[model samples]
Target: MLKILATADIHSPRFLDLFIKSLNKVKIRPDLIILAGDLVDKNNIYALKHVYEILINKYEEIPIISVFGNEEYRGFENKYREMYPVFKWLDDEYIILEMKELKIGIIGTRGALDKPTPWQSRHMPWLYNYYRELPLKISAMIDEARSKGAKYIFLVSHYGVTYKNLEGEPRNIWPYLASSRMEKIIKDKKIDLVIHGHTHNGVRDKINIDGVEVYNVSLPARREVVLIDFTPKSKVFGLEKWLYSGG
Candidate 1:
C-alpha cells in the first residue's frame, strides 16, 4: 500500500500547533508528505522554516513535495525554492516515485483560474494570459510522465478543480477561485486523483469529477492532515476518521 499524507493552506505558524498535534496521532508513517500550497502567510518567509522543521523532525527522510500558493507570490518563487532546498517544489511540473510495484507521478501547480481575481487583474495582468496557457502545458507534462512509465497519476494544485467542492464558497467568485479550463484537462487526461486547496469554506472535502476523485485538504476546512492509502489493486482508502469540521 502507498500512503500519502496531504494538507494545505497552513498559511503560517498559527496552524502549526494543530498540524503538529494531528501528525502525532498518525500511527502509520506515510511514504510521502504533500503540501498543496500556502505554507506561509502572505510570504512570511521566516515562518516557513518552522513549518518545514516540524515535519523534518517528525519524518526525517520522508520526501516532502509542494506547490506554490497565492501567498507565496509570483516573482519570489525562485527565492522560496532556493531558501527551502528540503522541499521538492513543482511549478506545473512532475515527479515520479517508485514504491515497490506502483509508479506514481505527481504534477503540482499553483493552478489556474477561469477569471482572474481583482487583485490579480490589477497587480498581475500577465496572469490573464498565463492562466489560458497553463492547461495546455499541464496536458503535455501528463503525456511526458506517462511516457516515462508512470502507472498512477496524481494532480496536485493550490486551486480547486471542480465546483462540487466549492459548495460553501460564493458562486459569483467561483471562477476567480479556480479554473474550469483545468478541470477539462483533468477529465480529458483521465487523471487518477486530484488534491488541492485554497477553498476554506468548501463544504465537500472530496468529490468525483468524471471518475477522478478530488480532495480538498485545506487545513482550515478539514482541520486535520488528510491521509490517503492507495493499493496495488487500485483500491483507495481515504481515512476520514482523521478529518473533522473546523466549525
Candidate 2:
C-alpha cells in the first residue's frame, strides 16, 4: 500500500507549527506529500522557501506535489514562480508522477468566483473570469492524465469542491469562497479523490460522489497531516492511522 499525506489552506504562520509537528508525528515516511494550496501567508518568497526546505529535509525520499492558492498569486505571478521552484505547480495544468508502477495523476486549479452568479456578484468580483475558465481547464488536465496511463487520479485545489463538506459553514458564503464547478468536474471525471483547503471552518470529512471521495482538509481543522492509503483499482481508501500533534 502506498502512503499519501495531504494538507491544505496552511496560510504560513499556522502551517509552520503544524508542519514541524507533522514531521515528529508521522510514523512511516510518506511516499507522496500533497499540499493542496494556500501554502504561504501572502506572496512571501522567504516563507515559501522555509516551508519548502523543511519538507525537503524531513521527507527527502518522498515526492512533493503542490498547486498555488489565491494567496500565492495575490501579488506578481512571475515573481512567485521565480522564488519557489521545488513545487510542481499545477495551476490550470496536469502533472503526472509515477512511483513503483503506481501512477498518481494530479490536476489542480486555484478556483475563483465570478459575477452573474449570486455568489460572485456580492463578493470576489475579481475572480469572475477565473471561475468561468476553471472547469474547462480541469477537464483538459483529466484527459491529459488519462492519456499518460494514470491508473489513479487525484484532483487538488484550494477551493472546496462540494457543499456537503462545507456544511458547518454558512450557506450564503459558499458561492464566494468555494467553487461548484470543481465538483462538476470531479463527478464527470470520476476522480478517485479530490483534496482541497480554502474553507478554514469546514470539516475534514469525505463525501462520496459516484464512488469518488472529496475531502475538505483545511490545515486549521485538521491541525496535522492526513494519511491516505491507495492501491491501484481500489474503491475505498483507509484513513485514521495517524494523528496531528495537536489534534
Candidate 3:
C-alpha cells in the first residue's frame, strides 16, 4: 500500500521540533510527505533556508509537495520560490505523483478564507479576489487530475473546509476563516479525501461529501501524522492510522 503522511500550518520554528519528533517516532517511511502550507512564519530567505535545511536532512528521499500559504504571498513570495527548489509547489495547478500501485493526484491552494463574510470585507480585502478564484481553480485542477489516469485524488489546503470541524471556534470567526467553498468543489470532483490545517481549534473529523472523506487535520493540538494506505481498485484493500495521537 502507498502511505501518505501530511501536515500543514506549521508556522516555521514550531515545525522544527515537530518535524524532528515525528521523524524519530515514525516507524515506517512514508511514500510521500505533504506539507499543505504555511511552512514558514516569515517570508524571509532566512526562514526558508532553515526550512529547506531541515527538510533536506530529514525528508529528502520522500517526495515532498506543497503550496504557498497566505503568509508566503504577502511580500516575499518570489524570493521564497527562487530560493527553494526541493519542494513541488501546487499553487493554482495540480501535481500527479505516480506511486507503486497508486496514481495519486494532488490539488492544493493555501489560506482560502471564506467570502461573503463581514470580517473579510473589513479586515482582508486584499484576499477577496484570491478567495473568489480558489474554488474555480481547484475545480479545474481536479478535472486535470482525472484526465491524467489518476485513480485517487486528494485536495490539500491550509484552510478549514467545513464548519463541522470548526465546532468549538466562535461562530463569528468561522465565516472569515476557512473555505466554505470546499464542499462543493470536493463533491464535484468526487475526490477521495481532503486534508487541511488552518483552524488550530478545529476538530479532526471526517465529513462525507457525497461519499468523499474530508479530514480537518490541524496538527497543533492533536500533534499527529495521518498515514493513508491506498491500493488500486483491483487490489481491494485500504487502511489509515493516526500516529502520535495514540490511536
Summarize candidate 2's per-residue lDDT along 59-104 as a digit string, tens digits.
8867788877867765455666676666667777777778877776
Task: State which candidate has the highest TM-score.
Answer: 1
CA deviation > 4 Å runs, candidate 2: 114-126, 234-247
lDDT string for model 1 (178-205, tens) is: 8888789988988888899999888888
Ten-residue stretch with the least lDDT total in model 3: 230-239
**What is the C-alpha lDDT profile of model 3 across 1-247, one tens digit per residue?**
6777777666767666775576566666678877777776765446667667766677668888877775575556556667887777777678887889577788877747776367447876767888877788888878888888877788888777767678767888897668778777777767777777766676554556666666665556346656665544552334354654431
> Where's the lowest-lDDT run of ten residues in candidate 1?
237-246
Model 2 poorest ten-residue lDDT run: 238-247
Cα RMSD to native, each candidate?
2.6, 3.1, 2.9
lDDT of 2: 0.73
TM-scores vs. true structure, each candidate: 0.93, 0.86, 0.85
TM-score of 2: 0.86
In model 1, what is the error at residue 56, expressed in angstroms?
Answer: 1.0
| Winning candidate number (lDDT) | 1
Each prediction's total of clashing residue pairs, residues at least 3 apart in sequence or on different chains, is 0, 1, 0
Residue pairs with backbone atoms closer than 3 Å in model 1 (clashes): none
The candidate with the higher lDDT, 1 or 3, is 1
User: What Cα-based lDDT does every candidate model obtain?
Assistant: 0.85, 0.73, 0.70
